[model samples]
Target: MKELQHLNKYFRKYRFKLLVGIIITMVARIFQLVMPSYVKKSIEVVEGYIGNNILKSEAKEMLLEYILIIVGAALLSGFFTFLMRQTIINVSRYIEYDLKNEVFDHYQLLSLNFYKKNRTGDLMNRISEDVNQVRLYGGPAIMYGIQTLTLFVCLVPLMFIKAPVLALYALLPLPILSVLIYQISKIIHKRSTIVQEFLSTLSTFTQESFSGISVIKAYALEPKVNAELNNLALDGKSKSMDLAKVNAWFFPLMILLIGISNIFVIYIGGKQYIDGEIASIGIIAEFILYVNMLTWPVAVVGWVTSIVQRAEASQKRINQFLQEEPNIVSTVKEETPIKGKIEFKNVTFTYEDTNITALNNISFTVNKGQTVAILGKTGSGKSTILDLIARLYDIDSGEILIDDVPIKELNLQSLRQSIGAVPQDAFLFSDTIKNNIKFGKENSTDEEIIAVAKKAVVHENIMGFNKQYETVLGERGITLSGGQKQRVSIARALLKDPQIYLFDDCLSAVDTETEEEILNQLKKESKNKTTLIVSHRVSSAKNADKIIVLENGKLIQEGTHEELNSVEGYYKELYMHQLSEKEK
Candidate 1:
């Protein structure tokens, strides 16, 4: 319930509709209460005529009038009940929509480290399944709760006013029912939380299995995967059964208590009637009607309690993520223009998850229109430099500056927008080739897309496809080959035409001939842009204005291509080895 207080703002947001629903509920119950009284009147009128208290014609007219009033009141009550559901249930749906958007927006604001700490499937389950559970509380539980309260308010006092002793006996089992519900509800809350957590785990395992199905088949691990999934399903079934067992107690308990109340109404009221302590037997019938009227609401109490407990458990999960503050917050509100002069001054960074130092006291400066190539062996921190430049992770020590302004002081969006980065592992969405390219620049013309595809040397391959750029890709662009995916990724960055271009081993998949063609085009296209190309091939770095070599997270060499080649060091050795391979 404390976690559920988060929804109070939404309740206030649609307070007008909820108020209307409440009014409709009260009116419906009031009209429904009119039925028992009219029923009593009809029964009394029949008794009067039998005892020679009234004529047949007058009695018939009175009975017909009472029947019509009862029918009319029933129809009105049904109509108002319909309106009550419309107003209240609709508000619940509105709140669900708002809550999902709120969670998604918060997810976007969080840093990459947050994603590293959480699984995708668990995040998805929180936004979807957990939210659905909360919706049950927001809609049906609230509606039935109000309905029960309205019936109690209108019916209970009427019963006591007519016959105090009978009312006392009829309500005797309710306190016991409440005590049972309290104990059951606590158990339900604990079990429901466990069930929801197990569901998240199951969802995570299933999602990962599906996403990596190709790997499973390649390794012939289908049997192993299926056995694991079966184990998870069996565990989930056990947890769900535990919850169902507790819930199964609700209705039978309610019915038993209600049955006892009905018996009390009959026996107690009958004794009073024979003693002439009551005016008529119709009063007993009226009391019986009132007790029966409470049946659904009383039955719903347990159901509502179960729903609230489940909802509270789900809300607590949702609140855990919603309260997370983003680590990388934009310091500047106003947008700053970028001219792509990047400087790294004694930057040190370590991966938090692995605690591996990716960069150590790395310092470099790139002028506004300089082309710098970074050459390094695997795990030598070439890619980390580009990530730091993009401000993906803040440095552990030292400062980064963009166009002479502290990187943190500049607008984060502006800084990132100015850079066009093609990572070592290119990722594409399950979308058309044209749309994937257009992701870099929405509303791009067909001519512009074709031009960039040619620049990236992927235009011919795309034209060979059946649908050209219109072909829809498989998940993560698996429909294309590795080289094609990389080229298409290059075309996307080329289309962006940002002030700074960071190419991180993007041409590793292409042949030397195609790589040369793409490099020539890139040299022409990026003439005035500040470019940083991180590659293993010396052919790619030979034409750069400056080259930097890294070894074991430390800068070992920095010079022009000719100077580095003249020196007998790592860059020259790599150049000689690559030159020999080309000669072969």
Candidate 2:
């Protein structure tokens, strides 16, 4: 109930439609009430003829007129019911569309850290399955629940009017049913939450296994992965059965309670009529019809209670996602174009839940047209530096500037658009080569794409395929070799033609000759653009205008190859080891 209260804002957005729907529901129910009243009149009309209140022919004519009124009320009730559904149900669908788009937009705003902490399949389930459950409650459950309430209120009083003793007798078991519904709803909500969480875990497990199926096959671990997946499926089934067990007990018990009410109306009302306390059989007959009307609403109360509980559980999960604040908030009021120059002034950063910093007191400057190479040992903070340049992660302390403007002060869209980065992973969507290169620059022409692909040295390989640039790649470009994927990633960046380009070990998969060829082409095209390369191999760093070497998160060396080689430090030590390995 509390979870639904939070959704009042969404309801308020379409309140007028909801109000009209409710009014129509009331009118339809009033017409329904007329049918039961006509049944009483039909019985009384025959009794009146026997008692001589009217002539026999007159009584027959009055009965025929009541019959027409009953039929007319029934038709009007159907029409109003249709109108109610058209207004209320359609609005629920519109709200569902808006809510989904809002959640997806929030996802786009979230930074890398959030993705690192959550699974893809878990998020997907929250958006798809959870939202759908909420829709069920918002639409049909709401309409039916209210209709039940209104019918209960209207029918019970009319029942009392026909036979006061029978109405009070029939209502004796209601308080008991209400108490049971409250208790059962609490348990149902708790169990439903557990079921939904298990569903999320199952979704995550399936997604991860499917994505890593190739690795499992290579390692010959299919049996183990399959066993784990089966266990999750079994667990999900067990919980569902548990919930089904609760429902099995709850729904039947509700029917039994309603049956008790009907039994009382028959036994007690029969005694009253025989004792001459009622005017005629019509009062008792009308009371029975009214009690039957109460039955449908009572049953619906139980059904909607279950729906409400499930919706509450789903709402709790979705609300948690909506509450998370996006790490990157763009607050820049003034926007300017980047000049490609970059400066890091005593920058420091540390990953979450860690004490050790990734970059400590790091300071460096790259002129607008310079090529800078970053060299470091494994876990020496090289890729972290490149990530900071594009604001993938924010720095803990100190300043990062682009063209004399603080990177933090620039709008995120313009900031990221100014830099073209190719990370070490080289992720490619499942699409054609032409579409992948044209991702960032959607309006890029065929001629522009060909030029960049040649600069990245991937044009020849693409031409070798049967479809050339139009050739479709599998997931993550699985059909392409490692070197091919890297070059394609580089080609994607080259097509952007951003002012600054950051490459993080992008050529590690290629041979030395191919790496040199790609690098040469990159240098030629990016002669006046800021280019930063993070590489492990000495060959990749030898020609950089400036080489910055890191060790233990500190800048221990900075200069060209000749200047660094003249000293006895980490750079020279790595250079000597490479030279001896080549000699061997």
Candidate 3:
């Protein structure tokens, strides 16, 4: 219950529904308790008519009235029970909806670091599987369990009124029942945590295998993947079985205590009846009604205990995720309508849990409308620069600025809207080429999409498709070639008409001729926008306004291609090597 304290806001919203359900449940329980009394009354009426203690006509009328009353009570109970169930279900759905929405909203608010640190499949499980399980076992079970408790509490006093000694005897096994359930609940909580984690791991594997099915097929790793999946499935099965094994022992223990309580009631109440200390059979029948009412609440003790424990485990996992603070957060106040000028002021960044800095105290500035190219070997922090510019990561030592104002002082949405990025690995959804191109600018006209696609040298290819711009690509644009995907991504970024454009090795997948053509078009298109390109090919960087070379997390050289070609440095050696290889 303490673990679920985060749900107070949602609970408050549906308090009225819960209140109505509880009231209906109480009404149903009261009506249920009255049924046995009606039964006893009917029996009494029959006995009186037989003994001739009353006139036949009067007894017949009394019996008819009693029968009608009993039927009405039964109907009342059924109605209230139905209404309670309806209300509780409504409340459950509402809570589930709210909880799911909250989790999604939180996931969106998280930074890129969160995604890097957390698996997509695990996050999916947390938002989907974990939330649904909590709703299933947590919400309705708790509601009904509470109603059951209320029924017992209300009827217990009534039982004492009917036969005080018998009532005490009926309650004698309660302590043992509670202790057993308490211990069982602890086990359930511990086991449920392990089960939920295993489920998450299984979900991770399932999602990864499906997403990378192409890679698996290409590598001919079907048997290996299947074997791994089998292991995960077996683990999941064993955990679930263990949960069931613990759950199985609980109900029988409850039944044993309940059986003992019933026996005690029968023995003590029978003695009282024979001794003439008990009143009419109606009181005894009512006692029996109380005893029957006790069964469900006691039995539900097992179920409710399990539900509560499971919920606690789930809540802990959810809260643990929510507790994670984003590594990148704005440290300054923000104002919108920013100018597109970027500067890395002696910036350095080292990832957590790593000794090596990804980016050293590097400094560079890309003025508005300027085109800069970053030339680097693999893992030379080319993409890291773009990440810092987008504020995907914060610098450990220095700051980044846009238009002389710290980027952290600009609204995140505003800053991002001003910049458009096309990375090395282009991604697309299963949507029409037109829609994919118009992704950033939702209301972009077809002409605008065609124009950008043409600039990126992809319009001819799109028109070659059977459906042209309307053709829907497969998942992750699998139907398209790697170069086509890159072109589409470029077109998508181009359609944004942002003030700053970032091409992080965007031309790597395309042929050199196509890459040169796209770069020429980008040079023309970004005449008034700051453009930055990260490329391994010297041909791609040769025409840039300026080029920077990086090595081992440090800026080693900065110049035009001609200036770097004249120098004896890393860039010069790289160029000489590529030229020598081309000659061979």
Q: Pick the candidate with the highest TM-score.
A: 1
Q: Give the per-residue lDDT digits (tens) of candidate 3, residues 1-584.
A: 77788777777898888888878888887887777778778877776777788888999899899889988999999998899888877787888888888888778878876887788888988887778767865357856786777777777887777678888988888888888888888888999999999988988898899889989999999999999999889989999999999999977887788788777767777788788887555556666666766888888878877887888888888888888776666554554775678888899988764556888999988888888899888888898999888888777998898998887787777788888899889999999888989996999898899999999999999999999999999889998999999999999999999998999998889987898799889989899889899999887888888899998788999988899999899888988987887789
lDDT of model 2, residue 279? 73
The C-alpha stretches of model 3 lying farther than 4 A from their native spots are 332-334, 430-432, 466-470, 572-584
Where in model 1 is the C-alpha error above 4 Å? Answer: none
What are the per-residue Cα lDDT tens digits for candidate 1 across 188-215? 9999999999989988998999889999
Worst 10 residues of 2 by lDDT: 246-255
lDDT (0-100) at residue 333 of candidate 2?
Answer: 60
Per-prediction TM-score? 0.97, 0.92, 0.93
- RMSD list, candidates in order: 1.5, 2.7, 2.4
Sum up the clashes in candidate 2. 0
Output the lDDT of residue 504, model 1: 98
Please report, as a residue range, the 10-residue window in candidate 1 with the lowest summed lDDT: 154-163
Off by over 4 Å in 2: 46-68, 463-472, 572-584
What lDDT does each candidate get?
0.93, 0.87, 0.84
**By TM-score: ranked, best first:** 1, 3, 2
